[model samples]
Target: MPLRLPPLPALRFFEAAGRHQSFKLAAAELNVTPSAISHGIVGLEEALGVELFVREPRGISLTATGADYLSYVSEAFSLIAIGTQRLPNHRADRPIALSCAPTFASRWLLPRLAGFRARWPTVNVSVDTSHRQVGFPVDGFDFAIRMSRAPVAGTAWTRLFGERFVPVCSPAYLATLRDERGALSLQRATLIHVNAASEDWQAWLDATGADAIETSGGLRVDTIQLAFEAASMGLGVALGRKPLVDSDLASGALVEACAQTVAAGTAYWLVSAEQADSAIRRPELADFKRWLVDEAARFDADVAVADAVADTVPDGHVETNR
Candidate 1:
């Protein structure tokens, strides 16, 4: 006994035609002529003894049977794609390309990427730091980290972490801003601003209810990294983003100028192309995704514990000699 089926090429043409609802479009996608698509679908109908398309003067559409059959065909192709990707030696040497914002790449990812390399030394990774939105597969990126308030359309994404902004400055710079009673005064302080996050100061002010402070003036820089450097050099106070500034804060290179942290209303997300059958199937991509997500989870857990401890401490409580 043998399996009965239409020609594979005919089925391929039929699936593409059914999906696009136009022979011209399907032909373009398959890099063939419209006549080839029409003939192929006709041959497929003749072989199956059933019409799969309703041809009209303007265009073509899937028949009821065609619509149902398309579902099966699409699923079959998807399974084939998944299976093909699982094959050994399937692009194992290809490096995993990633795209993300420059600030995030420098401040957050680069610091932690060594851990990933240590874990999966065989998988090479190339990172592109660009703020421009990229088209999947076309841009040649297997993964991306994006900061956004809403999900990007036509992609699968996982929330990395929400952002919180706080004022930070070098210890020496902060010392100049404190008054006799040890209260911070911002009236005479120079505000450092990042052009990419122009509204950060205003947002922070509104969240803290500091109506007297004006945000019209500042040492504006194009990048958050530069602004941080300027602040670390004791130039002024920079609005620091968590996780990015975590290392600096821990090292005592930068300290909170004030005690307020405000939600940024946006979060970091790990994104991959919506049609990611091939990329997602790769072991290297899978390992990298898992490692990145686990790292973010651990950071979140640590932040939660620190917040819990901070909440328990009474406000304005100071330690003194007994």
Candidate 2:
């Protein structure tokens, strides 16, 4: 049988040494220590049962086998790199990479992304969603959106929107309550609670002064998006993040049964960097920002309208259910 090559990692080391002709140079090129390069090449040579290089005081030189192998190795690595660079664009001709919080990605941002895709038919977007606070340069994120209470310390942070949280459920659930004061009946509904936050129904009850409910029963989820999902499915009433669950509310998947909103102590922001903010030069980011600001203004107007409705309505008619 012909000789089977060693594994990829070992082959790569031998290939580096064959071209550069010095294990030291190969080590430097690969960002590995010299001993690592030596060990890797030794493994490769043992596997191949052939000596491919010669070391001399002057320097290292390639044997006939080494010279021949270098050509194939170089070509292989070049093709591999080209293949890697093209992976993100596999679905399209062009690509734009974006990063954001996973929950925001699943809920609000994703819903709006179709419009961007429709408008820019050629630009494919790859989303990287995570909750770990990722820095721009260190993390290699192109553009990102983040939700937070405090301003980010070292970046060009653009205020996207501030949102309040409210108790929401299917309107059918609300209609069943006998006493309006018991509406925050954490005891009755599945109080779909978000996990990342420190509090649950117990904390919510304490904060809102809703003393009647048990505040102990409910399924807990890791993200606001999941809470909204449960609420939409009628699994429970969720303390909904307004930005995330607004679509659900509008679609009647869920309804805002209470007018009381507990400030979530956080807001969402569009973020990039001072340098990478140049991505905004593409005009897509700017357009999105404009539309988003308009939407937030509309939401604020709705809040004002709700306040007006509450103020004008008589105390008896103001149904205290929410």
Candidate 3:
């Protein structure tokens, strides 16, 4: 038996009208006259033997049956679009869209993008900074890098790296904290805070058993990059996440304020499009996933080396800059 369906044009008109809740608006969207939309809907209702919309003096509204039908129609459109987008003619030059946390994009991912471009010259990458978790496919994002302790449902999650929070400050500022006892104490020093990473400071204090020091008073920066910059300028001490601070720490811009770090247990996760089939069908997306995992692994290896080196330092021995 042949597939029983309303006319394609009628279905389109009804779907548009139901979405906008106005025949006039649907006509404008479909580039047709309001009378045409009305005729299409009439034909659709006759075909289905059901009244889809309640015509009103001001505008049209979906009937109970129409509202239910609209959901299936909209979802069908989305699936059709997804299938079309995965066709071979979709082309490779299309940019891979990724949404990530601002600090991760700035301090970690942006620097390494040149390497990504070097490896995948034909593939372009677009980055959108956001803290909000994205819904893939519907949100039109190929991937999202979210900071969380666990994987998100309905997406492929690849663990990046767990957070290591450490107290960092400028050498000049550290000098100001030193008393006649030749010991540095944060009790008298101002703390720098990031509104988003506020828990870092408390975690550090809790882990180090330095609860006596007041962590409440400080300049609050909105992003991790800004907090790190503020700390490097001798403004105050900031609890820095290792991934964002590793380069600055290695270059002497920011020094460890104490020989203590708190394992935050939270990690960066690369979330692919909701469907595994999407990645398998789109080579560019697969390439992006592979590249991101490789970069994260390289970062973890580097951090491991740094941790080993720091371990070699004798206990309670803090390096002082002359």
Q: Which segments of candidate 3 are over 4 A away from where they belong?
A: 1-81, 87-92, 317-322
Task: Give RMSD (Å) of candidate 2 vs. truth.
Answer: 14.2
Model 1 compared with the native: what TM-score? 0.68
**For each candidate, what is the lDDT?**
0.82, 0.66, 0.81
On TM-score, the leading prediction is 3
lDDT for each residue of candidate 3 in 192-261, tens digit (9 for 90 to 100): 9888768778877777777787777889988888998999999988888887888898899999887677
TM-score of each: 0.68, 0.56, 0.72
Q: Please give the RMSD to the true structure for each candidate, in Å.
A: 11.0, 14.2, 9.1
The residue pairs in collision within model 3 are: none
Ranking by lDDT: 1, 3, 2
Q: Measured by TM-score, how close is model 3 to the native structure? A: 0.72
Q: Over the stretch 3-107, how does candidate 2's per-residue lDDT look in tens digits?
A: 665689887787677766778877876789989998887788788888877878888788898888877776666556445534645333334556788877777
Angstrom error of the Cα, residue 149, model 2: value is 0.8
- Candidate 1's residue-wise lDDT over 1-322, tens digit each? 8999779998888877887788987787678999999999899999888989998898888999999999888767766655555677676578888999887898888889999989888889999885455545544578899988889776889998887888899999988886677766776578999887798898988887776776888799998889889999999989999878888899999998875778798899999867666644567888898999999999888887877786686644211111
Please state the error at residue 150 of candidate 1 in Å: 1.4
lDDT at 113 for candidate 2?
Answer: 70
